[model samples]
Target: MKNEYTDHAWDERDPSPWLALYLDQSTPLPDEVKAAWLRDCSSSSRQFFLPLVRPMARVSMILIQLLKIFLPKRWSHSMLLHRLLALSMNRFVSPEANWLIMRHFHLGSQVLAFVAANAPVAVTATPLTPMVIDDVKDELFLRHDLNLFNFVIRLNKALRTENKELLPVPEPDFSMLRQPDLRLEDMPRGKLNLLDLQSAIEIYTPVYQLLLTDNDFWRASNSLQLDETVAIYCAKILASPEHLVLLNNKHPLVPMTTLYAAYRLVLHGLSSEMLHSLLMRMARGEIPVPARELAKMHKAAEAVAAEESLAP
Candidate 1:
């Protein structure tokens, strides 16, 4: 991979520049229009209102959790009570925190898909160890937070540039960022009973379905330019032996692997139905290796072997 493509994967200084660029270019709107759209979507004002309601939301969440303990396992998993509690507590939390709770599942799913697509050799060679799953979960959470922070910063900057009166957004009080402990704790743990690949797909499908219903994600998936950029990046990472090793070894910091792969498929013009079918097949170990992709991996491995042979 070229420096530009590979550097962004590890560089934390400027979070998700590639994704940000994709976002900026994909949604073509004039400055004023963008600012207006952001203003309408802004939840900054909710911060001021949150203090008044925070205590109540916290109490409500606690009661819900207590009720869950007394409920049957099936009843507890219904998500009805959870959804209600989340709705009530939503305004009391940081947008990033809420997103982490609500959308991180989807984000993690996308990351898994990327890994499965771009690092097939590594994925097939390695067992899906707990450490690997944890790494994926952590990356998903980090990317979710980074992307949220970047979006807010960019929105504010654009608003300021347009001379729009900034929304009076308060600094997030991390203490108030609470969700159900059970849910939060479960994010890092993959299902252990199933076969490794089956478990990954099972973990991902619910969230993937959730994302399919999300208007924002749907719109982004439709962005041809963004998809192409992401696809190109995925291809680069797929070709990088170091990246393959990191992914196979479950490196702690392999960022945005899944998101890039999901976008690549989206950009490659797979319909949702087709994409889902592909994921199912991939998970079941039924996906045939594309000759070109396989050839690229073989060639890269040969180059590595040759380089090692020459080394003292």
Candidate 2:
């Protein structure tokens, strides 16, 4: 993979480049090239807002933990405390970043799928060692924060079943944005599970679903060796080779950090694409916005007739 592709993956530098692209308009956006901008918007928003609500999410975490002591682990999440916590997220959190919060699950799933199909059989055939699971779990939690390792196990079961149970997404209205529901549908999380069984899965690499138990999938999770192995396993599976190609020809060293980068990237890319598309429609009289508004878009679209000329 090229440096341009990896340049944006784990860094804070703005991938938006809206000003540059808007002013220049020379950069071509071929289908595959968009991976460079494929940030899962919802996840980024959640992380960004996390600092604001961590105190509460922390409280929720503690309450959930306390319930685990008295009840089955399965029952812990159903406690009033947990329900309130999930509800608070919709109430207090900013509505801006709702792209795909469980993107890691989907990405992780694809990584497993790729490894199962492409890696040597010994890996996919073997169950992950119980001893090693502790190490991988801690590391994955540190990086991805999928609630907790226990929660991830549950999330995985939900994610891979015949009827996929994607981690819940907050349903804040994004009606002002272009076809926000469609954007949600466009996300690749749940769809990535058992990808071959369905239509095209939105991964950077070609992936095939492999029949394997949960243990087989978690081993490449890089027991205490996550850094060295992230790229070897993830390389081009989650982030694309042409876009967010991983460092050292590898992918995320810190998966959640990479996840955040992706979230911002996706949000910016979507906004840019939407703005450009709307400008084009307006310029073509397919929309009713004024010529001045078209001009305001930095001439990203062609000139159009005045608003009065656009008759119904």
Count of clashes, each model: 1, 7
Best-performing candidate as measured by TM-score: 2
Model 2, span 117-230: residue lDDT tens: 432222221112112112232333223322223333443454455454322112211122221122333323332122110011111001100111223213323222233243
Report lDDT (CA) for all predictions: 0.33, 0.30
The count of backbone overlaps in candidate 2 is: 7
Which whole-number lDDT from 0 to 100 does residue 282 have in model 2?
A: 36
Residue 15, candidate 2: alpha-carbon lDDT: 52
Model 2 CA lDDT for position 206:
12
TM-score, one value per model? 0.24, 0.28
Clashing pairs in 1: 111-258
